[model samples]
Target chain A: MTRPAPLAAGISAAAAAGRRAPVLHAEALQLRFGAVAALRDVSLSVAENEIHAIIGPNGAGKSSLLNCLSGFYRPQSGRVYFDGEDITQLRPHRRAAAGLGRTFQGIQTYPSMTARENILTGFHNRMRTGVFGALVWWGRVRAEEEAFTAKAEEIIEFLELEELRHAVVGDLSYGLRKRVDLGRAMALEPRILIMDEPMAGMNPEEKGDLARFILDIRDANRIPVVLVEHDMEVVMDISDTVTVLDFGEVIAVGTPREVRENEAVIAAYLGTE
Target chain B: MLPTGVLFETYSAEAGLLKTARARVAVAALVLALLAAPLATGAYLQGVATHMFITLIAVYGLHVTVGMAGQINIAQSAFVGVGAFATARLSEFGLPFFIVVPVAALVTGAVSVVFALPAARVKGFYLALTTFAAQVLFPIIVLGLPTSWLGGLVGLAVEPLTVAGRPMNTPTHMYYFTLALTLIASYAAFNLHRSRFGRALKAVRDNDVAAEVMGIDVLRHKIMAFFVGSMFAGVAGSCMAWVLQFVTVESFTLFTSVWYLGMLIVGGAYSPIGAILGVAFITLVQEGLHELGTAILRSGAQEAGGAIFAATNIALGACILIALIFEPRGLAHRWQVLKTGLQLWPFPHR
Candidate 1:
């Protein structure tokens, strides 16, 4: 596979650390919207530095799972644990403050703000001062803002978005907007990055570029990723472990090679092979 | 990595008004012109200018609620009435005008938060109707109060505002005072546009769900916007009390709230300058129409002049509808288009 040797070594060390302490754990999660069961006892665990991809058919509840984890939706009968803390009832902002970052299925860029300003918002929770400090622009607030800017610059560089950084997010192309959205999430410096359909509407060339960027982020940051994607080839190529979901139930969970050859996954995709 | 010097230079690049040399010059010109208005204009014109500035202040309040937060509020004139009555009653206790003004604003701001309660659950047209109820109820409540504190329907007369031992009774003095306060308010509003609170308000306006997802307390920002907006309206009403030397139920009527909204629509909702421009334009137009009516009466076209005076509401209604249809964003957008067109002369791309 020609993975960087040093990166592979670092990944192993990170994996060991991750195994010692899992970052996010969900137990017996159940969510219902009126009569329909959106999620039913979907227990899942995400380790600190592992790339976990969640694959599913059209209504398999992948998004609902992500939403529950991020505090957008409160499950009726389950608890979510982050860094060994019970966070089932925490608000989204509190979750963001505690190092959980996510991007939406469609880009949610603040159209009025420039790309830099959009990314700066991701660092809102990290800012030390309240309204007074910001108004005066003094002391700790200045230091915090500078630190955030430096970190944002690093993310912009990593994403190769230097030219697009000054442009308003509303004016950017869809591919560029997606990259900016990812960059914003990275700016949060989250321990766990949850992406909803990160590769939904990209050309092949754009896909290749994004694939490289995703790999670099995972390798460099050692941050675990929970990706919900439709592209089987990209998921198969990059995901360390794959969980196949169908009809709101886990069809299989294993290494990519094992999941690919499973009769059930093939049948779910091809309709009775 | 880019060179340190180059990176620093790029990072320091200013956005908004601070970035543009032309905007700086324009601001300077505006300040100078405002400072000179009292010197150049006559007594009646100065009085009109003072009225215009006070109306501008109230419109700025509407700007915060409608323009920035995207919340519909038609009860701003009721808040203004609250401020006016509060200022009048407080001043009657022999308190200084300066103290009375701010206290009136704070009281009105608190009352505005009370009015904003329904904003948490309702929005758009329904919220507008709720505020409309406030506007309708305000005059009735003011008149129904048993105490003569609010002057009942007869209203109360306000003493002249004295500054530093000098009574500001003349039109020129009132003009200068109103102009100074208006300028300060405008500058503060402009500074707020670049503040985090301003961005939060805009975010909530654009999409409350996304704003919540981004960690913004949508309800808090919405209420804060209402408070700030109401404070400006209070200040304006207090100044109006000083200028008219009286406070009355008729002065801050439901019709006045509609006029303020029309001014904002005509001037530009998003631009602060639009608030001032809209007030000035509407005031001048109404005065000119009044003068024309007076001239026609003198020139033997008495019946036509009487008809025009009686049908002023029709004229105002038509003007508002036409402005909305033709220039939805108001005068500020038109001004922006013109400026941009000039800046990009011969290129023709916005």
Candidate 2:
């Protein structure tokens, strides 16, 4: 398999100096629904191969931020750049084709499909087969399908979901479905993966497993992750950097320890002073 | 699930169409039975079988749109009309059966794309209404054309299908033609369901927003769904023209489209076999009711003719309603249950 092109156009010496270029850059994003502002001038950057957590209390626009980055919600103002290319105007699928992948706040696996099929869908953009090729099922389409199935199996193993690979996703537990969703996103082989509330309803153990997977995604897969998570302990434990949002605005941006000790983040999470 | 005691060591084995030895034998026997049907069957039964195969093809077309891609296509019959009319025109030009069929499919597929474009902007009831407009518009367009083009409401007479300079108009020949085409269509559909293209469409059906975010290009796939569907309809329409040797607006009606949807529901929209089963059940029921209606009229119950005539429609509606309420997944799921039971007979349950 060919390596994915670096998220940034030019992974320069400056980037190689441990000060990597931001793979995804959000600039002063402002989103409004009717008269209500969902996100107000929220800007954050996710660097190469790092877990950048977007954390905040309810209605703080963490999800809105992830939505903008993932190209779901078009912000009223501000631009999103990936690999130095502006992508604010790209549609969700286009952005996905451009190597942006995401998981929904709600699990979005094709319920009737098996876990293997669900994960295989994540490789949608990568496959080169068209309608005729798929119908005929030979040559390029066949080879690519075999390769991708192998890749999907590898991801299933990585997530420890080999047993659940052929199981219908709808019949699986919520936690397993969530893992399947992640595996699907991982199949996209995204340059940067954005997840919405990966551990929202998980038990502590499941949360731990998911957090480890997120870290492995960053460190081992070398893909940057933009995680919108609410659990503070998991956030602080896994995040290389944390950007705190409060009422549609970015209140703090720093390392996990810095954000945890920040006065504003404490106030936002635990009632204002 | 893997059949009771069966295990697959390779991906191909796991993904094979028939799993256990029993399944292979059953499929083989079924194919042999179908192939030898003409030998045992008379002309009337052969015609019924031929019509069933044609409806099976059409219903499978509807399945691709309504079942696989989750698009509601009320214009299915209209697209079929596109094929029928195109075949009428192409056959009029002295094209061979083999050539005319594919050309009809292509023409209908293109027309389907026109109908499908509205799907890029709208869906559900609104999308259904959009295709409904096509359904309303198709017959008018055909009848409005110059007699030289479409023959108006009188319709056009189709030339006999020929292969290699030999007439294929006999019941036996037509049966083989329909069966061969149906087999090819079913094979293509079967492969498509497991292929990347089909999976992408199924993803779109399951959740369009999720499919889009996953980079499936929902609009493109929706268009593709319509194309494949109408292409199937086109092929079916070609077969229909061969069966009737006549093309008329009355043959392709809005009611027929609805009946096709009913067939998909009864058959299990997601399964090709369900399409066949649904077509077989619904067509046989309609024929049975037709005979009943005739018998009622002959027995001096002339007034009951109208009621008996409406029985087919009522029966179709009831079948759809029952399937939706009690077995929304359709007969395919039920078949799976039965197969599982058989596979694990002594074991009782999985």
Candidate 3:
């Protein structure tokens, strides 16, 4: 408990169990904003313990794909399946409750709350104590709160945010806020984490820190990751499988190296202004 | 903000309402003062203190709904009116004040849920307008009823508050009664602030999208805030009924709703102490203005009392303006700054 256990244990266990079922599968998604098509015939799958990266240009529908996957945007025609159960039409909160966790493109935390409180808020679905228990603050509420705070503390320690745990999120630096946002998502203990531009607007050092955190979230925690990213270096380095999109269409999908060397991906990147 | 240089090694210690030993001592002293107040003060002062406590209860509700939950509820006084009428009707059925008060609170809470239902779709100005409709429509509905139903604007007289066959006739007796209810209400509010539900409400308030993704049911929390807030307002309204000995449609006006909100803003909408301080400060200002107007009339200023009575409204407006401009966070933030400065005196505060 002092340090993160090797997620390889979980990965090996998953492999030994011979589970090939995709943790998440999106099929032929078609999303349109009025007359403009944002995603057309886009399909992808994230396996257990895999970090799947979706990379593309500004108008390449990377965000739209993430939105569809997380149930924030309903695809005009598509099916999203989590654990092989169709969830294409579920509401955002319902999806989250069904083990879909996400961090926004813009770092979002409870602004007036402390980092600890913000992280604790992420455990909303976990806590079962009701209004009467909360108002009374008796044995049950205190116990649940203590248990959850300990859980939240583990995440804080994992992220090395001990000093900033009590700091108000509004006053924290951007890098710290991003860490807190990730910590919030991690608090859900989701089977799959969907991050939109997790390293956006970060300096190289901050980006490195975030990239390591993302990898830790995937490898150390053994959680499947679905990321929409712009930083190609981090994407190629950490991503297990890469799906490249261009003009709302999938151009290539393979291992990171395969996608990196794909003639179509090269043309898509070079062809953009 | 705990005392400077303090360190809490446990979550309970850090999250405790009285985090520092100094705060515990201060609260103990305040409770002692509150207990002794009835004996020390005259009837007029006791009456004023009773009013302050009642207003604090209502403001605390507003603080939860508007301040923490980030739902603007202008119809809080309407909820209060609902409570008062509920109390009046229940007393007519020969129920005791203790039973009648809680019934009133529950009734008003249920009524607030009706108003809050539409909040699932509307937000900000639109939501405020929705609650405003409650404020505007409440009196009309109350007055439109037959005279036998809700007194038809003439109002209904509340039966005397009695507990265990003892009539609470004197202001001192009623003060103790109000004090007990206030203590219970404030304790619940304090506990609620550190509770999981309270944190969830804040999360929804800060960013509903993030809250939803974090698995918080935003609409449920918003409506819960309204329910709890109106429940507190209901308690306050029952207290007001006892204080006034009557319930009237005219008493729960839009002006009354505005007054409650102004008190919240002046006190700081985020804390119970802020609500209490806000109600106390505004009540004192109104009384002082009235006293000033009386003195002016006694000193041969013809009709100055009427003008001064009108000037009290102007002064209330000025108080809100000044608080908003100078300390938008309210007196609670000012109190915090002062306390922090004092705690770290002789050293540079970070």
Tens digits of per-residue lDDT for model 3, A16-98: 33746578878778999999999888777678898899998889999899888887899988688888678988888888888
Better of 2 and 3 by DockQ: 2
For this target, which candidate reaches the highest DockQ against the unseen true structure?
2
lDDT of 3 at B322: 99
Query: Native contacts retained by model 2, as a fraction?
Result: 0.73
Q: After superposition, how far is residue A50 of candidate 1 from its true place, in Å?
A: 2.7
Q: Please give the lDDT score at residue A155 for candidate 2.
A: 96
Off by over 4 Å in 3: A1-19, B4-9, B303-306
DockQ of each: 0.29, 0.68, 0.67
How displaced is residue B28 in candidate 3, in Å?
1.5
lDDT of 2 by residue, A182-236 (tens): 9999998899999999998999999989988888887777988988887888888
Candidates sorted by DockQ, best first: 2, 3, 1
DockQ of 3: 0.67
For model 3 the local lDDT of residue B294 reads 88
Docking category for candidate 1? acceptable
Which tens-of-lDDT digit does each residue in A173-241 have in candidate 1?
Answer: 888888888887886778888888989899998899988988888889998888999999999999987
lDDT of 2 at B132: 93
Give a tens-digit lDDT track for model 1, residues B197-281. Answer: 6666776776676566666677777888788888889989888888888888888888889899999988888768788778877
> lDDT for model 2, on a 0 to 1 scale?
0.86
Candidate 2 ranges beyond 4 A from true positions: A1-18, B293-310
True contacts kept of 1: 0.20
